[model samples]
Target: MRSEPTDAERALWKLLRAKRFSGYKFKRQVPIDRYIVDFICFNHRLIIEADGSQHAENAYDEARDSYLSQQNFRMLRFWNNDILTNTEGVSEAIWTALQDETSTPSPQPLSRKGRGALEGAHNG
Candidate 1:
Protein backbone atom coordinates (compact mmCIF):
# COMPACT_ATOMS: atom_id res chain seq x y z
CA MET A 1 0.00 0.00 0.00
CA ARG A 2 2.34 2.71 1.21
CA SER A 3 5.45 2.39 -0.90
CA GLU A 4 5.35 -1.38 -0.86
CA PRO A 5 4.18 -2.38 2.59
CA THR A 6 6.89 -2.69 5.20
CA ASP A 7 8.27 -6.18 5.93
CA ALA A 8 5.94 -6.73 8.83
CA GLU A 9 2.92 -5.63 6.88
CA ARG A 10 3.88 -7.89 4.02
CA ALA A 11 4.23 -10.88 6.33
CA LEU A 12 0.95 -10.15 8.06
CA TRP A 13 -0.81 -9.91 4.74
CA LYS A 14 0.47 -13.34 3.90
CA LEU A 15 -1.49 -14.80 6.78
CA LEU A 16 -4.50 -12.47 6.76
CA ARG A 17 -5.40 -12.94 3.14
CA ALA A 18 -4.91 -16.69 3.10
CA LYS A 19 -8.48 -17.43 4.22
CA ARG A 20 -7.15 -18.77 7.49
CA PHE A 21 -9.67 -16.38 8.93
CA SER A 22 -12.51 -17.11 6.55
CA GLY A 23 -15.22 -14.64 5.49
CA TYR A 24 -12.90 -11.69 5.98
CA LYS A 25 -11.76 -10.11 2.75
CA PHE A 26 -8.96 -7.60 3.02
CA LYS A 27 -7.91 -5.31 0.23
CA ARG A 28 -4.47 -3.79 0.05
CA GLN A 29 -3.89 -0.16 -0.82
CA VAL A 30 -7.55 0.68 -0.87
CA PRO A 31 -8.10 4.34 -1.67
CA ILE A 32 -10.49 6.08 0.65
CA ASP A 33 -10.57 9.79 0.02
CA ARG A 34 -7.00 11.10 0.19
CA TYR A 35 -5.83 8.30 2.44
CA ILE A 36 -5.24 4.79 1.26
CA VAL A 37 -6.12 2.21 3.85
CA ASP A 38 -3.82 -0.79 4.11
CA PHE A 39 -6.77 -3.13 4.43
CA ILE A 40 -10.51 -2.60 4.46
CA CYS A 41 -13.50 -4.92 4.95
CA PHE A 42 -16.63 -3.06 3.84
CA ASN A 43 -19.01 -5.62 5.31
CA HIS A 44 -17.79 -4.69 8.77
CA ARG A 45 -16.90 -1.07 8.00
CA LEU A 46 -13.44 -1.80 9.37
CA ILE A 47 -10.17 -0.29 8.30
CA ILE A 48 -6.87 -1.87 9.24
CA GLU A 49 -3.80 0.32 9.25
CA ALA A 50 -0.35 -1.13 9.59
CA ASP A 51 1.66 1.46 11.45
CA GLY A 52 5.34 1.76 11.03
CA SER A 53 7.22 3.41 13.92
CA GLN A 54 6.55 6.98 12.71
CA HIS A 55 2.93 6.84 13.85
CA ALA A 56 3.69 7.08 17.59
CA GLU A 57 4.84 10.70 17.45
CA ASN A 58 2.59 11.80 14.61
CA ALA A 59 0.07 14.55 15.35
CA TYR A 60 -1.40 14.14 11.87
CA ASP A 61 -2.20 10.56 12.70
CA GLU A 62 -4.32 11.62 15.64
CA ALA A 63 -6.33 14.02 13.53
CA ARG A 64 -6.67 11.38 10.89
CA ASP A 65 -7.94 8.85 13.38
CA SER A 66 -10.40 11.41 14.72
CA TYR A 67 -11.75 12.11 11.27
CA LEU A 68 -12.08 8.42 10.49
CA SER A 69 -13.83 7.89 13.80
CA GLN A 70 -16.33 10.61 13.00
CA GLN A 71 -17.00 8.90 9.72
CA ASN A 72 -18.16 5.77 11.64
CA PHE A 73 -15.29 3.64 10.47
CA ARG A 74 -13.56 1.53 13.08
CA MET A 75 -9.79 1.61 12.76
CA LEU A 76 -7.62 -1.29 13.81
CA ARG A 77 -3.88 -0.67 13.95
CA PHE A 78 -1.06 -3.11 14.28
CA TRP A 79 2.61 -2.39 14.67
CA ASN A 80 4.80 -3.80 11.94
CA ASN A 81 6.93 -5.71 14.37
CA ASP A 82 4.02 -7.12 16.31
CA ILE A 83 2.18 -8.23 13.24
CA LEU A 84 5.20 -9.73 11.57
CA THR A 85 6.56 -11.25 14.72
CA ASN A 86 3.30 -12.64 16.01
CA THR A 87 1.02 -13.26 13.05
CA GLU A 88 -1.09 -15.87 14.82
CA GLY A 89 -1.93 -13.44 17.56
CA VAL A 90 -2.69 -10.79 15.01
CA SER A 91 -5.05 -13.13 13.20
CA GLU A 92 -6.78 -13.94 16.46
CA ALA A 93 -7.20 -10.29 17.28
CA ILE A 94 -8.62 -9.52 13.87
CA TRP A 95 -11.04 -12.40 14.06
CA THR A 96 -12.17 -11.39 17.51
CA ALA A 97 -12.88 -7.86 16.36
CA LEU A 98 -14.66 -9.09 13.25
CA GLN A 99 -17.14 -11.15 15.19
CA ASP A 100 -20.63 -9.66 15.30
CA GLU A 101 -22.28 -9.37 18.67
CA THR A 102 -24.70 -12.21 19.24
CA SER A 103 -26.84 -9.91 21.37
CA THR A 104 -27.57 -7.84 18.33
CA PRO A 105 -30.14 -8.91 15.82
CA SER A 106 -28.97 -10.46 12.58
CA PRO A 107 -30.12 -9.06 9.25
CA GLN A 108 -33.76 -9.59 8.37
CA PRO A 109 -34.48 -12.18 5.73
CA LEU A 110 -36.24 -11.36 2.46
CA SER A 111 -39.88 -12.38 2.09
CA ARG A 112 -40.85 -14.97 -0.54
CA LYS A 113 -44.49 -13.87 -0.61
CA GLY A 114 -46.25 -13.02 -3.87
CA ARG A 115 -46.80 -9.45 -5.06
CA GLY A 116 -50.12 -9.36 -3.28
CA ALA A 117 -48.40 -9.74 0.10
CA LEU A 118 -47.27 -6.56 1.87
CA GLU A 119 -43.57 -5.91 2.02
CA GLY A 120 -42.39 -6.41 5.56
CA ALA A 121 -39.16 -7.42 7.20
CA HIS A 122 -38.98 -11.21 7.22
CA ASN A 123 -36.71 -11.06 10.19
CA GLY A 124 -35.34 -14.47 11.13
Candidate 2:
Protein backbone atom coordinates (compact mmCIF):
# COMPACT_ATOMS: atom_id res chain seq x y z
CA MET A 1 0.00 0.00 0.00
CA ARG A 2 2.85 2.33 0.79
CA SER A 3 4.57 1.77 -2.52
CA GLU A 4 1.38 2.02 -4.56
CA PRO A 5 -1.15 4.41 -3.08
CA THR A 6 -4.37 5.02 -4.97
CA ASP A 7 -4.99 8.45 -6.49
CA ALA A 8 -7.44 9.32 -3.75
CA GLU A 9 -5.12 8.13 -1.04
CA ARG A 10 -2.28 10.09 -2.54
CA ALA A 11 -4.42 13.20 -2.69
CA LEU A 12 -5.55 12.89 0.90
CA TRP A 13 -2.02 12.21 2.06
CA LYS A 14 -0.95 15.57 0.69
CA LEU A 15 -3.33 17.23 3.16
CA LEU A 16 -2.81 14.84 6.09
CA ARG A 17 0.92 14.27 6.15
CA ALA A 18 3.42 16.10 8.43
CA LYS A 19 0.78 17.15 10.98
CA ARG A 20 -0.79 19.37 8.32
CA PHE A 21 -4.35 18.39 9.21
CA SER A 22 -5.01 20.34 12.43
CA GLY A 23 -1.51 19.67 13.73
CA TYR A 24 -2.27 16.03 14.42
CA LYS A 25 0.30 13.47 13.32
CA PHE A 26 -1.08 10.80 11.01
CA LYS A 27 0.62 7.56 10.07
CA ARG A 28 -0.22 5.79 6.83
CA GLN A 29 -0.61 2.08 6.33
CA VAL A 30 -0.42 1.38 10.03
CA PRO A 31 -0.83 -2.07 11.45
CA ILE A 32 -3.47 -2.57 14.11
CA ASP A 33 -3.82 -6.12 15.38
CA ARG A 34 -4.76 -8.22 12.33
CA TYR A 35 -5.59 -5.28 10.09
CA ILE A 36 -3.67 -2.53 8.39
CA VAL A 37 -5.44 0.81 8.46
CA ASP A 38 -4.98 3.36 5.67
CA PHE A 39 -4.37 6.36 7.93
CA ILE A 40 -4.45 6.71 11.69
CA CYS A 41 -3.98 9.49 14.21
CA PHE A 42 -3.06 7.87 17.50
CA ASN A 43 -3.30 11.18 19.34
CA HIS A 44 -6.99 11.51 18.51
CA ARG A 45 -7.65 7.76 18.41
CA LEU A 46 -9.13 8.20 14.93
CA ILE A 47 -8.79 6.09 11.81
CA ILE A 48 -9.42 7.38 8.30
CA GLU A 49 -10.25 4.73 5.73
CA ALA A 50 -10.37 5.43 2.00
CA ASP A 51 -12.68 2.94 0.37
CA GLY A 52 -13.00 1.98 -3.27
CA SER A 53 -15.94 0.41 -5.11
CA GLN A 54 -14.93 -3.02 -3.88
CA HIS A 55 -15.54 -2.09 -0.25
CA ALA A 56 -19.28 -1.62 -0.59
CA GLU A 57 -21.11 -3.57 2.15
CA ASN A 58 -17.97 -5.56 2.91
CA ALA A 59 -18.47 -7.89 5.88
CA TYR A 60 -14.81 -7.67 6.83
CA ASP A 61 -15.14 -3.88 7.11
CA GLU A 62 -18.14 -4.26 9.42
CA ALA A 63 -16.13 -6.51 11.71
CA ARG A 64 -13.26 -4.05 11.57
CA ASP A 65 -15.55 -1.21 12.57
CA SER A 66 -16.95 -3.21 15.50
CA TYR A 67 -13.47 -4.11 16.69
CA LEU A 68 -12.20 -0.57 16.40
CA SER A 69 -15.27 0.76 18.21
CA GLN A 70 -14.65 -1.65 21.06
CA GLN A 71 -11.12 -0.28 21.30
CA ASN A 72 -12.46 3.33 21.44
CA PHE A 73 -11.12 4.23 18.01
CA ARG A 74 -13.43 6.23 15.77
CA MET A 75 -13.38 5.43 12.07
CA LEU A 76 -14.28 7.81 9.27
CA ARG A 77 -14.77 6.21 5.88
CA PHE A 78 -14.80 8.09 2.59
CA TRP A 79 -15.47 6.78 -0.89
CA ASN A 80 -12.76 7.24 -3.49
CA ASN A 81 -15.09 9.42 -5.54
CA ASP A 82 -15.89 11.68 -2.60
CA ILE A 83 -12.25 12.05 -1.74
CA LEU A 84 -11.33 12.94 -5.26
CA THR A 85 -14.23 15.21 -6.15
CA ASN A 86 -15.00 16.81 -2.79
CA THR A 87 -11.66 16.93 -1.08
CA GLU A 88 -12.66 19.99 0.93
CA GLY A 89 -15.71 18.28 2.37
CA VAL A 90 -13.70 15.23 3.33
CA SER A 91 -11.04 17.40 4.97
CA GLU A 92 -13.66 19.39 6.85
CA ALA A 93 -15.28 16.24 8.17
CA ILE A 94 -11.92 14.93 9.32
CA TRP A 95 -11.20 18.25 11.06
CA THR A 96 -14.57 18.20 12.79
CA ALA A 97 -14.03 14.67 14.00
CA LEU A 98 -10.58 15.57 15.29
CA GLN A 99 -11.94 18.54 17.20
CA ASP A 100 -14.72 16.40 18.67
CA GLU A 101 -12.20 13.90 19.94
CA THR A 102 -9.76 16.39 21.52
CA SER A 103 -11.81 19.37 22.62
CA THR A 104 -12.40 19.84 26.39
CA PRO A 105 -14.73 22.23 28.18
CA SER A 106 -13.15 25.30 29.72
CA PRO A 107 -12.81 25.52 33.47
CA GLN A 108 -14.87 28.03 35.46
CA PRO A 109 -13.11 31.30 36.27
CA LEU A 110 -12.51 32.30 39.90
CA SER A 111 -14.19 35.47 41.19
CA ARG A 112 -12.02 38.40 42.41
CA LYS A 113 -12.74 37.52 46.06
CA GLY A 114 -11.87 33.91 45.47
CA ARG A 115 -8.60 34.91 43.84
CA GLY A 116 -7.74 37.18 46.81
CA ALA A 117 -8.42 34.38 49.28
CA LEU A 118 -6.25 31.92 47.39
CA GLU A 119 -3.47 34.50 47.03
CA GLY A 120 -3.50 35.25 50.75
CA ALA A 121 -3.35 31.55 51.60
CA HIS A 122 -0.37 31.03 49.32
CA ASN A 123 1.48 34.19 50.49
CA GLY A 124 1.05 33.38 54.17
Q: Quote each prediction's TM-score.
A: 0.73, 0.79
The regions of model 1 sitting more than 4 angstroms off are: 1-3, 18-20, 100-124
* Per-model root-mean-square deviation over C-alphas: 15.4, 16.5
- Tally clashing residue pairs in candidate 2: 0
Q: lDDT (0-100) at residue 42 of candidate 1?
A: 76
Q: Model 1: what TM-score? A: 0.73
Backbone clashes in model 2, listed as residue pairs: none
lDDT string for model 2 (7-52, tens) is 9899888989998987899999998998889999998888887767
Report the number of the highest-TM-score candidate.
2
Best by lDDT: 2
Number of clashes recorded per candidate:
0, 0
> What lDDT would candidate 1 get against the real structure?
0.59
